[model samples]
Target: MNLNPDQITNYANTFIKVLIDYSPKLISAFIILFAGLYIIRLINRFIRSIMVKRNLDPTLTRFLADILLWVLRVVLFVSFISKLGIETSSFVAILGAMGLAVGLSLQGSLSNFAGGMLIILFKPFQVGNTIEAQGVTGTVCEIQIFVTKLITANNQTIFIPNGSLSNGNIINYSLQNFRRADLTIAISYETDIKKVKEIITAVLANNPKVLKIPAAEVSVKNLTDSAIQLAVRPWATNEDFWGVYADTLENCKQAFDAQGIVIQPYVRESSKSSS
Candidate 1:
């Protein structure tokens, strides 16, 4: 409180001396921090270039590059802090604790993220693939980190969480180059079974989209009290699957009607007589 001039001057000199001694370290730290940032950017670009060369999934590549960039930046920050004589162990510990807290609070989101990674890695289905999963059938429009967008045949868009999509049963109709259209038409038992089979065979053969090498099949699938179900399986390219399916059904109906074949509900002959 009552310092002499000598004491004040001594204190001032000591302060100046400390600043001079630490100036080099401060300058060095700034240089290192800036240089490290530039290096991190370079590393990020390098990794991205490699990903592109490998023809990696675009989503995965983007996600990985972002992760790498952030991780390296964090390390660079910690290194800069340590150069300033700061205790980095405590900083790291605090970061770890914060990460754990955030992870616990966002467990569902983290799960979805992990699920997305799995999907990208395993490729259960990709964008534009027609798939059926979780009771929803659609063409996959987008495979994002948290959700997958599907465009249904009715032109409705559905967003399915990746967490469920990764774990659910996925049927990818687009995976195969060719698909078999299993068309079952129920005909009245009064119709001649042999004649019905002949008509179905002819219909399949007439369809240009249907593949002939595998040969289409028309056989009795089940016999009910009132009707016999004929299983008409025709192979066609995936692109023509829907076209062949719809056309085949229409053709079968026309052929049957022309030949006087009838389709009926499941009613027993005895019940019909009683009515």
Candidate 2:
């Protein structure tokens, strides 16, 4: 426990000498790190602006930008580490091992990511498109890196993993400029088929929503045990598809009532009353 002023002085001088020797390198490394970060941000923004101007797919643009930004950040981090005189070979090896572990654990996520990439590249369906897939029907809201968001007709939000969506059959109702509304209504067996068709045709002709080019038609689709099934096929713009569908059914029902055509009840009534 004896105090040594000479030893303390020697330690202080040695510390100061080491600091002075590395000060320039430390300062240079800090400057480079800051400059690199700033440049990276600038590049990210520049790339985003370019993609926006080119009208590139938003999903793919955002995904690629994120990837580029992260890769640049990782490279900059490695550079900063190397500047501190730390060997990066071991650091990179550690990162690789960690990445492999994460990749293995997130196999499904990786599959979804690949599927998302395929969706963006193939252009199967885009945002705002009404699609039916995986036993669900909805309008595509957003296509993210791993999942596709859909807004159902009943105002429900659905998130479908890209892996499943990409592999399954996707019915893109909005792919065409126009969509056909397929409807079936059962009428009494005694109802005249020819007159019913005429009445439905007239109703369709009056409705402004129905596309005139395709010309809506009504025909006997099937003869069920209870009633005759009439098929109503009408075309309308993709945007007006749902509106036309609902309107057509309503108008047809009113027309049938006015024309004295009997629309049979779905559930048949028993002739004998319960005691």
TM-score to native of every candidate shown: 0.88, 0.90
- Candidate 2 lDDT by residue in tens digits, 144-244: 98999999999999999999999999999987999889999888878888888888898899989889998777888988678888899999999898899
Error of 2 at 115 (Å): 2.0
Task: Tell how far residue 89 is off in model 2, in angstroms.
Answer: 0.5
Top model number, TM-score: 2
| TM-score, model 2 to reference | 0.90
| Highest lDDT against the true fold, candidate | 2
- In model 1, which runs have C-alpha deviations exceeding 4 angstroms? 1-18, 265-275
Q: lDDT of candidate 2? A: 0.91
Model 1 residue 113 lDDT? 93
Number of clashing residue pairs, candidate 2? 0
